[model samples]
Target: MDVNGRVWLIEANPKPGRTLFIKTGERKVYRTSVRRPLQYAMF
Candidate 1:
């Protein structure tokens, strides 16, 4: 998701029920979410 001037990639695993996150700036041109809550929303 794109927020402010940055983006975030969220990954979700169904089998293990876990989530992962990565900053879009750190990702490649097109390297790509889970249902986990986003903390940035508070900001």
Candidate 2:
């Protein structure tokens, strides 16, 4: 996100082809699902 300034991203699921967690946190909101690919991140 150069336009929006420096933004860092992380990979939620380190394992490939496998989902370890999904929809983490209720307030901040975090998602990681093997079923879904387009939307998922690891902190």
Candidate 3:
């Protein structure tokens, strides 16, 4: 963030750590995150 309190996105990771949500006990989110891309590709 800057002096005016505006946030900036300086970088992004194309492949973020996948196990984070799992570690946080968000099993449903983890499953959906892994599933959606495969479903989209199959469609």
**Which candidate's TM-score is highest?**
3
Residue 28's lDDT within candidate 2 is: 24
- Determine the C-alpha RMSD for candidate 1 after optimal superposition of all C-alphas: 12.5
> What's each prediction's TM-score?
0.18, 0.18, 0.61
Could you tally the backbone clashes for each prediction? 1, 2, 0
**lDDT leaderboard ranking:** 3, 2, 1
TM-score of 3: 0.61
Poorly placed runs, candidate 3 (over 4 Å)? 1-14
In model 3, state the lDDT of residue 29: 97
lDDT of 2 at 22: 34
**How does model 2 fare in lDDT?**
0.42
In candidate 1, what residue range of length 10 has the lowest lDDT sum? 27-36
- The digit string of per-residue lDDT tens for model 1 on 1-43 reads 4667776758644653232224334333223223224444545
For each candidate in the order shown, give its overall lDDT on alpha carbons.
Answer: 0.40, 0.42, 0.84
lDDT of 2 by residue, 1-43 (tens): 3677876665555654333233233322223333246643242
After superposition, candidate 1 runs with Cα above 4 Å error:
12-43
Q: Model 2: what TM-score?
A: 0.18
